[model samples]
Target: MVASSILSPAIADSLYAQSPFHSDQHDARTGKFWMTSHPTEPGDNGVVPLMKHWGGEVASMWVRDTELLAPLREIGRPRIIEIAVPLATTPDSYSAAKAVVATFGRSIGAIPGKGAFDLYTNQALPPSAVLAIHTEGDPTFVAMGRTYPTGFVDVDAGRWKELTGEDD
Candidate 1:
């Protein structure tokens, strides 16, 4: 939910939409699934590491910068070579949200990206972190500030469609 250059709302939407929560793999890789533009083919690689930790939980894509894009590209999910517009918020707004989320659980920073405000959930995550906040049918949660009600970057839907070819 933290703003990230590595992840985009479009890519996040695709990944979230494509995930089949059940055990889609037979390698005894519980929670393992593929991320592909072609859903029929098995995923290019196992998201086991990401899955083991984030499996069965709604995840917020938090990236520090474009560095996370390589992994996402390797995984073959939707990759936007050029994002028309990315999202951002004032440091004060981010800090305020951080305080609210910190009340429930811990927050972590993103690496290999940019600015340090890329706070994401990791250890000691509370159940509330996975709670959904409907704001355009994108499976959003509340801890992160969306433009609506918070004046943060909500990842403009029109721009997302232009970049990823998916309408919200």
Candidate 2:
């Protein structure tokens, strides 16, 4: 089934801006800021599904849930930025993943059903981007094609903790 609620870029950006943990960097390659955040509190444990927002269109990964901490442990606490694009209408389901590949003209990585959100990128991402897909359901089912950002910058864990008062 398709998502009944679609978030506008302005609303998304406003919500993102409200978070002190949110940050973005100017991407010379795309000429737009790539945003990321550490949106969870320390000791927060739960399954975070994968979601994608391209331009203005939003899509949820077929997989329902994934470990939230896996990516942080694997990627060394990089700024978890939101992926935003100009605007486009893309179908949901596997087509969402395909749309990302088509937009970037390259193969994208897929986070397995039981996998953590651990994908990272060393390059600048296209306007279309991925985020933790938040949803409710069983966490043990097989996942369809799901993609995440291929580029991300690492952040200092100690400094982040100091700033946010989050104890590890």
In model 1, the runs with Cα more than 4 Å from the true position are 1-116, 134-146, 150-168
Worst 10 residues of 1 by lDDT: 34-43
Please name the candidate that would achieve the greatest lDDT relative to the true structure.
Answer: 1
lDDT of 2 at 17: 51
Question: Estimated TM-score per prediction?
Answer: 0.18, 0.18
Which 10 consecutive residues of model 2 have the lowest summed lDDT? 138-147
For model 1 the local lDDT of residue 138 reads: 33
Encode model 1's per-residue lDDT on 1-168: one tens digit a residue: 226444667756655654443334323333322221111111123322342222223331333335433445343222111111111312234544544454333225321111123222213334443333232223222212333224443222255565568985
Residue 113, candidate 1: C-alpha displacement in angstroms: 17
lDDT value for model 1 = 0.32
